[model samples]
Target: MVKKNDQLIVTIEDIGANGEGIGKYQGYTLFIKNTAVGDKVLVKVMKAGKSYGYARLMEIIEPSAFRVSPICPIAGKCGGCQIMHLDYEKQLEYKEDKVRNCLTKIGGFDKITMEPIVGMDYPYYYRNKSQFPVGKNKEGKVVIGFYASRTHSIIDTDHCYIGADVNIKIIKFMRSFTEKYNIEPYDEVKHTGLLRHILTRMGYKTGEVMVCLVINGKDIPHKNKLVEGLRKIPGMKSICLNINTSNTNVILGEKVIKVWGETYIEDYIGKVKYRISPLSFFQVNPIQTEKLYNLALEYADLQGDEVVWDLYCGIGTISLFLAEKAKKVYGVEIIPQAIEDAKVNARINGIDNAEFYVGAAEEILPKKHKEENISADVIVVDPPRKGCDQKLLDTIISIAPKKVVYVSCDPATLARDLKYLHEGGYELKKVRPVDQFGHSVHVETVVLMCASSEAGKC
Candidate 1:
């Protein structure tokens, strides 16, 4: 019988959704992290359950052909990126399999077409945003870095390879400024101190940067010195302060005060200008986002004179993109701030066709469709990680748009929602996975579906 502390040899047969390697040991399933598929490893059972167990990879007897050396030394320790050890090509393949497996097993789809995953030419340093937690380590020294895997404990680091190179300089400057000025790092336990996190956003196209310091209070001592140091770095457009006095895990507060520079930074995504504030919900990867949105646009197949509805539209990013092709586009979002931003974005871009509405997609879209007697030729939904609400799916089915474009962040939830839509007489047409979060287990997918009556497949 398998017991804790038992050392066993296992051949990893598959990779789990969380990027852990799945292998069997004497009829017991073991999940060992940091091990790739087709890898033979010696594992020590950490927790042995009846049918499944967790293990620690003690030794890799044979590495998988797709295994590659990890670029980040602290990749395993940091919760940021998993599967960095896997080759980039293989990572794309694994993501494709992940989507397929979810659709087939969870959605109960018999046959579906999955296009090749859209990957970055240079996957590293693609993230436009980085949020490093600031806290004191065991030695009582202020440190700033990402939290360890599944823990709030901060790991001291000088740089994050996946983030913008400028983040390293920003973090270093903040650490030095805090040390020199004797600024206190926020203690999550006691809920004291000043600095909590350093949030930085870089514009890939415009080369503009926004640095916002999340603090326990409104003011920081020696603020001028901090701003002066940060301004030394090129492309420093905005330096703001966010006040968060709560004891919660939420990073940003409701109050945002400009400390030094402009209130917002500008970025362009394919001729579409976006004015991003500190709390705007913009895509972290602008390069991959363009590709993803382009694919979504293609799936939408808008040919002017079509009325398109973009649900869960954050800041009207996708809605604006669709507005250029469709005669009229209506965007619905739950957050009032995001809706305001969407309206501002539409106005700035001179897109009179797109209209912004503030409400839940399920409630607003259904109600609007019923009251206005509106018909959406194409409906594009980019829901959050929880996927679309069931009522939203019901509404979409009831509307019976000619085309449905679903942009999903979580494959499992996407599959579940897709199953509901499929059962509602919608047939899955095409799906293309986009590697927006490179080196991480998370993948973004764009799926195209149409009603069976429209496709003549029913």
Candidate 2:
């Protein structure tokens, strides 16, 4: 029944919360991509494991009701997004169920309850920010696009389903700049190039956009010429240069120097204006972020007088929100630039009750607790895909805040963090999954945790 690279016909039994197809063949697990949960397909095993195997669907014998035609031509090959073929309503259910299952199956919480997932009003074009890598096409024409998820290669794109028109135009505009300079693409193996990345951020309501040009070297030849062209972009907040020469392929280039235009982008939410710099981390979707943050503030049960700690608070979005109602809010982050931006944002909004600290959550939180000898009523963590560090979870337990709000972009990491928190005597009282990016597997989750002694089981 099982052999190396054996072809097997199997029905997709279920879907993991991450949108990975779930199937089993003779007690061996198989994860196949681009297939719906109800589809029966013949798959060729790509890699076999002791317990689980990776596969690709070679033949679809029976199609599932959830399956729909994918609009993107490179949907399967590009690896940018899966579940694009699934119905929108079904996608919502899958994300919600994925969060619930994680609480029950992984966290082992008996009384866990979940609210309905928050569906986006306008899912497509929900992302107001996007970063595209600039490279060359087959004809050697300058092409800017996202990387192919499957191959880690460039997927030459003109207009992404999620990016706004302003960003698309900018990308198209970059072609001439790259061509004029004859900037060679940075090959990971060879490691030679001038250009690296083009990052763009736009505000849905304010109509302000920020674009940062990242290069592999500090002194780009004919930098003045490039600056002239980049500044010509209408409504461009910043057109600075980032110098990144590391062996790693991380999009961010170190040592950003102001070439022309402002160095930061101004993004507005409600009545508050937040300035986002080249290195600052902000939510790509501004429309849903308002909903996301407000819901989180409600879940935190903030009372304007309570002390709130926003961990990994990039540019202090949540801390500023809480500052409106809280007596004092402190945001701790490792990126000092982001902390500086947070400080500026607070000052800009006349929010004197908020402050920013620069450091990792796992280290800074405990130090603040011990050195300051203070306890917080609430804690909010909006961590990267890697989730909260274990040490930070331990510190959170020691501090024992009455309320904890966790915002995550990845479900698997969120679930892992939840398990750790559950072990630390926190119960998952409520959770809501919000889909900010449509036609993609991306989901944003907000979870509220309370002290088990005061809260009922669940």
lDDT of 1 by residue, 93-144 (tens): 8999999999999999889889999998898998889998999989999989
Q: Best by TM-score, which number?
A: 1
Residue pairs clashing, model 2: 111-458, 112-458, 304-325, 304-326, 304-327, 333-359
Rate residue 291 of model 2 by lDDT.
86
What is the Cα-based TM-score of model 2? 0.91
Candidate with the greatest lDDT versus the true structure = 1
TM-score for all models, in order of appearance: 0.98, 0.91
Off by over 4 Å in 1: 456-458
- Per-model C-alpha lDDT, please? 0.92, 0.80
**How accurate locally is residue 34 in candidate 1, as Cα lDDT from 0 to 100?**
94
